[model samples]
Target: MNTRQLLCALTVCSTLASTAALAGNAPLQQVQKKWAECQYSTPDGDEKEQCFQHAITRIGSYLDKEPGNPELTVWLAINKASLAGAQGGLGALSLAEEAKSLLEGVIETSPQTLDGSAYTSLGSLYYKVPGWPISFGDDDKAEEMLKKALEINPAGIDPNYFYGDFLAEEGRDKEAKVYLTRAMQASPRPDRPLADKGRKRDIEATLGKLK
Candidate 1:
């Protein structure tokens, strides 16, 4: 994988939305907006990391106040995962671990919460992180959780993209192309223009690689 593909692979901690059609709390919305800018529009790695850290801090405060607020907790996990993606290596392992914990908490709040996004993201983390004594990456678990995510969100863009990317890396090119094409066909989130655009780039790149 080259630079963009590398970025896409790391950023599997991509956008996560609320379970309901209703608007999320203000803090969650702010974090999502900043996350998008860092993930896509912002070009500087340091700047993007800074943005993600800021979101981590900001969302952390909300989580502190609310304690068990499921919405805030999920976004906190997402931001932390974003930080992990930005930082990479051993330092990223710590951040991803925290993300996993927070995501689990969110799932406990409700299994189907965030349209099973906790499962989707946690699944992505398992596959993306380094394996063994180094970290807890597990391909079997990744597939299981990702398939669960698809059951919850069959038409969701992120789950399809990550699953397809995983299959491509595993050299399951035909099956990977099927999911990537489905991802391209998935509905766009009007609230997340930059995320949608960036993911499309990833989907397209992965498709080109398979061909």
Candidate 2:
């Protein structure tokens, strides 16, 4: 082809590529906004759950458009897991299982992408409920996941707080106290709450027991 024709072709190609990139980012940005909303939707647990679900739906769609987006997939999984925790009931188990699988896929793709958030979700899944007759709670798994989370983000309040609860529930208050104190130290503010209040209360009660 002529030089001018080749240059025109390259410009068109670049424009199309840029447009596709912008399109991919559009959904991701929307999903992230919803995720931030979910973080502070504490007073209305159900609303918080719905906000996360909205994030999942949006991010899931983004993943459909960009199937190999490991970070987005992990975020979607974590949000779904959070939704399950915010509104735990009959069907929440199924949702949690789905989140677990998605996060596992994220780990498979890139363990580094299985960040503190992903591990925290897994930890909560295991820590919050009971086994079999009760649900999907297993303190052993909780400890494992939470420890993994802390390994990734040791300064994270969620990991420290929940891991403390896990230890306390297992009657290991000595170790649990270390985590609880760290959680309080990491606490953001009254404006931006940490994890779930109920979970935080559990952590406090566990610490109280330890004291």
Candidate 3:
């Protein structure tokens, strides 16, 4: 091929690649915005639960188109988990398990995807859910997974906070305080104002009890 023709072909390919990248980003961005709005702006426990329920519906629409996309799967799991957390009690057990399964799938597909969020999330669930014949909670597994998460994202707020919370549950308040303090000092995420603020509150509330 002529040099000019080759250059034109390269430019076209580049443009298409860039366009596809933007197209991919748009849906995830929209999903994130939806989550932030629903989780951050909404007040009242019942209302938040309702909002998350709606969030699952909104995210589920995306999954309909890209069911196997790891990004979409993680977000769907997150949305369901949030709904369950807001609901609380026995009714949320099934939802939590569903989140656990989705996260496990994400780990299989891409363990380090989203900065190892799948591992962090799964670890949090292990501690939060009820154990024994009732649910999947296991302190040993929780610690193992949380430590793995820390290895991947040591400076991340969520992993530190959850690990600290788990320690507190196990009566390791001193160790828990260290991690919680670290969680407070973790670098900020500009795009995650709601999650950061909420997590900070969790850290402070936990720390307050330790003191």
Q: How many residue pairs clash in each candidate at the backbone level?
A: 0, 0, 0
Kindly report which residue stretches of model 1 are placed more than 4 angstroms away from their true locations once superposed: 1-24
Ranking by lDDT: 3, 1, 2
**Cα lDDT, all candidates:** 0.84, 0.73, 0.87
What's the TM-score of each model vs. the native? 0.85, 0.68, 0.84
Tens-digit lDDT track of model 2 for 26-52: 665556556656765445666677677
User: What's model 2's overall lDDT?
Assistant: 0.73
Candidate 3's residue-wise lDDT over 112-203, tens digit each?
Answer: 87778888888888988899999999989999989999999999998999999999988899999999999999999866677788779889
C-alpha root-mean-square deviation, candidate 3: 5.5
lDDT of 3: 0.87
Clash-forming residue pairs, model 3: none
Across residues 4-121, which tens digit of lDDT does each residue of candidate 1 receive?
9988866663433333433546666777788888788876678888988888888778778788877677778888888788877697888999999988777777768778888888
